[model samples]
Target: MTGILRLLTARRGAGRLHWTDWATYAYLGLAVLLMFGPVLWLVLSSFKTPAALLEFPPSFLPMTQKEVRVEGYPQPLPLFSVTMEDGSTRELAQVRRVGLIAQMVDPKAPGTTVRVAADKRQPVREMAFAVSNYTEPLAKYDFLRFLENSLFVTLIATAITLVINSMAAYALSIYEFKGKTLAMLAVIGTLMIPITIVLVPVYLVVTEMGLVNSLWAVILPGAATPTGVFLLRQYMLTIPRDLIEAARMDKASEWRIYARIVMPLSAPALAVLTIFSIMWRWNDFLWPLAVLTKSEVQTLQIGLNAFQGELQTQWHYLLAMTVVTLTPVAIVFAFLQRFIATGIANTGMK
Candidate 1:
């Protein structure tokens, strides 16, 4: 209890910035909720029933049809008086409506399985749950195929990015040569050019290279990222020149020095780049869409769009799939968070 209190007090202390700090923290919290509240609501709605989902007074925890069915036992069923076609009132024994089923179920049997009669006149509208809404999307669309393709592209691209970025950064930071200034300028210059500006030319090149509809279309283009190279170069510059000199004195080859010394010393920076590369490649949508034309080759983000068609969108299954998709990124972030923090601390200044 004291530990909890201490933690709360610490949080409160951190939140306070004189008198203005409280207001700043309050504003930040509100801004965060404003951005994420809708997303939270969408995720919550996935668990709700169809009727409750579209209900006016939004249900917090909508009841399911399964709740009504207890094996060989029935609760005192509520009397919903329905007017018959003959204009006479009749109590429904078990009409099997949405969010409702009439059955004599056993409540006392602890482990007994309950059975509900089907193949009768089942009402389709006003379903008690979002089961169909969720399952249909996975079955109807090639969602799993898309997930596999997305993983393939992201893993390959991340691997390529790591190799290319590390080598280029080593060259720029450690090796002095002609056009080095021009090379740095060129890399930095790309920051000014929006990717959209080169889309047409890039498309033409990819099409000519016969790489369209292949994972290479996504992987190859993403490998030479200027941001990755630039970030790595700055970190590499922090490596002490003495280490390289010592390595040379030992008669070590350049490759040996880089492999044994530079690589070992660059752990924190590599961790930072690994996290960034994973997120960028995993959640990437636009370029993958432009390059890959085959339905089988589409990534998760594009596959998500395919789930949203002209007429209908399955919010429930889509939200569930999103949760599944985001799990990996969350896991990676949680594991590598310390390394990322260290990288930020060392950026440029170190």
Candidate 2:
């Protein structure tokens, strides 16, 4: 009994030490910084002012440094105005105010000037916290409409993609038929074809179908992803043939077996496909940009274009809007991180 307990304890301690090794900690630390570093900068910069934004070597937090302090009373600066000499009119001449030490010295009272200098340092401009920085100019853009359109397209694309790709994948995975290899070869062959080469053709097809500048143009193009079909088919092929046969013997139709048995079993691969679909659709800028011409119809990716002018770009407003635009995708990815994990775990089971 004593020998067995010692062996078990040694094994457990060895396992613990292995997992907590320096290499493991190093990898973990690098992974965390890669994932969260940019996000930290974005959240911190969102609350900063325009001056502080451009301030070199930047302060990450809001400016709390005081710039100006008043002792007795708030002295408002005088506004100078000039008048024409043609009418022999007198006018206030423009001049920069001198430092407090020089003003107090007054040539006649140089003694008091030293005392005044000792009493006060130049006032620093009070640190201005512009909450409006994060709020104001950001309100000027039409992100709500962009967000709505993006949501509509992403949801529709994901659902339709899952359905269509799963059906195609199921057919490719289970059934043995003539021309099967030929069909798959053709499918895979198209993967190598550059989308740019097909751009004009796709545009014409949409134009012929009267889908120009419509939501359908964006949603429908991505509904049938070749990669999703391929990934799902490969994963589904790993399902045991006996399970599928048993389902059919129990009076289950192929579609029902697919829905009830195959889909549930293929969750990891499906998850992988789902992540890819969401990311691709979400990041789909070019196609949506090509399809959507009106600002009202534009997607989130194109919202950045709204603030950009031919000669100038609004950096501060652009940064604020970019932070907002990135937020939802980040949230979605965070929630779906499990899907990516499973996808990686079960990538090549077959």
Candidate 3:
């Protein structure tokens, strides 16, 4: 790992770079842009005001029109740089707009007004972030409640998924049952079935169980994912059977063996599953949307969806809320990603 980091970050000696090296750097740069450019845009746009968001020629940075207080005006007037007829420019404050013409006043001489073509004037703008875009929604909406619900659902569901999937994987990998092959095949076969097909049946079952409008409605239905089971079972198969035999010879109980021996050794695979489960539960919308109908039970994603109205959508608030929602998932991935490649690459070995 240290060698890999050194190769990645080390400076080159005094030599011309090879064509392949240039090509590799270009590919890496493009890949990084493709992966993170939109995310960076989203974060930056979250800071923009509503008017800035609606601007035709979008800017990379958050900016707002500069305003100045004029003597006669009751409110601050928007400042503009007006181009004069003889190719001169002056800073003026816009009082009003009448079709193609704009009523402007010089900040120094507020008593006099000048009429200029609106096209000839450009609004003075400065880098400004609309923090209210984030603050207003958190204040007006039940943001904390929704965040709590989302956290509860993600954490509980992920825990349940890990426990259930790991146990299933343990059974399938270690035990010598009569129909073990058929059971493994059946587990793998579920992967071919799309979640859409199962939605109605799952909802019906949850309704029958009186879990609708409850967090469990979303959590329980997806607790045992086939992908988790398959990945874990493949990884568990690589564990030496002699370990289990030695534990048995030492009079270790099955539960003790599973808890102490199997689980610790499967940490990398479990970490991989934990990350997958967190992402799945955190970003899940359709299942929760179908299950959680009440405002009290809604997750952050559903709450964010509420910003859309029949006629107009609150893009500014929505973007800000999206950034807030993505933060926890990003943190989880950052911490657990070290085990991902190792878990995946070694799953099929031996």
Candidate 4:
């Protein structure tokens, strides 16, 4: 019994590390890298120049261009630096290339051209940022207008969603009525049907109502999502029926009870739905594309499509605009993430 108690109570030395601990930490490190690696790359790549972007092995950092003088060359050559054979570095300019060997010009002297190894010259690049990537797109493309459109749509849709879904949930959860179970089941049934199945019909309805090309076409259809109704209903079910009864005993109107008592208690769930609604409205591309014909009224996601043309894509500008588009979503998630945890924990309690 003493031996068993000793074994059970034994603690490892503070300095001693276990293999399991190491493995757990390694796994966590890898998980974090996997999750955040692309995001880090995206942010860094947004600052890279077009030449740096096109380099064979991609550079992780942003770079700037510099002009260097070659003795025989009529004009200064655009040269980047590279580490050479003896671990020394040289500034080499790309002139032209044959199948394998690249014709490089030494910018330091005129009439100095050499056949350097192909793809071997790294541009003598300094850490550079092209603010123009963001500025030009915003100024030329009217990205601010699209951003405003997205914000307006997201806020209005989210507010309407919360009010309508909460009301539906309150009615279903608290009130005793005939066919209540069937009604709840019907709400859940909508979940099985993919939104794609209803896309054409919804669009047709919007067109018939003459709401095509209007932001309302986007906002009105999704104002009361079945998923929101289900989430709030599940949460509202956890609220005590007695409190609602007590409110009723005070002769409180149903709307008064819901607005004052239920909405306050269900705040966590509301926050979760708010985040979801924002993401939905912000990232929605296809429907907005179909409904919104004019560029002035489009969302940020639609505006981003302008960066791609028939012949070429402006990846730098696209990436910078992408970063701008993501900022608001990140801010919203950061602020409300705590509520998500609270909602899940409280919902699980009942």
Candidate with best lDDT: 3
TM-score of 1: 0.73
Kindly give the stretch of ten consecutive residues in candidate 4 with the minimal lDDT sum.
7-16
Ten-residue segment with the worst summed lDDT in candidate 2? Answer: 101-110
Q: How do the residues 111-185 of candidate 1 rate in per-residue lDDT, one tens digit apiece? A: 533233333223222335456655666677867888888788778888889888989989999999999989999
Q: Candidate 2 local accuracy as lDDT?
A: 0.70
Off by over 4 Å in 2: 1-24, 64-134
lDDT of 1 at 63: 43
- Rank by TM-score, descending? 3, 4, 2, 1
Higher TM-score: candidate 1 or 4?
Answer: 4
Cα error, residue 127 of model 1, in Å, equals 14
Query: 1 or 2, which is superior by TM-score?
Result: 2
**Candidate 2 versus the native: TM-score?**
0.75
Per-prediction CA RMSD (Å):
8.0, 10.3, 2.0, 6.1
For model 4, residues 136-167, the per-residue Cα lDDT tens digits are 98899999999999999999999999999999
Please give, for residues 34-104, the per-residue lDDT of candidate 2 as tens digits: 99887887766766666667876777765533322223325432222223334432212111345532222
Which pairs of residues have clashing backbones in candidate 2?
67-124, 67-125, 67-126, 68-124, 68-125, 68-126
User: Per-residue error at 308 for model 1, in Å?
Assistant: 1.3
**Which candidate number has the best TM-score?**
3
lDDT at 153, model 2 = 87
How many residue-pair clashes does candidate 1 contain?
8
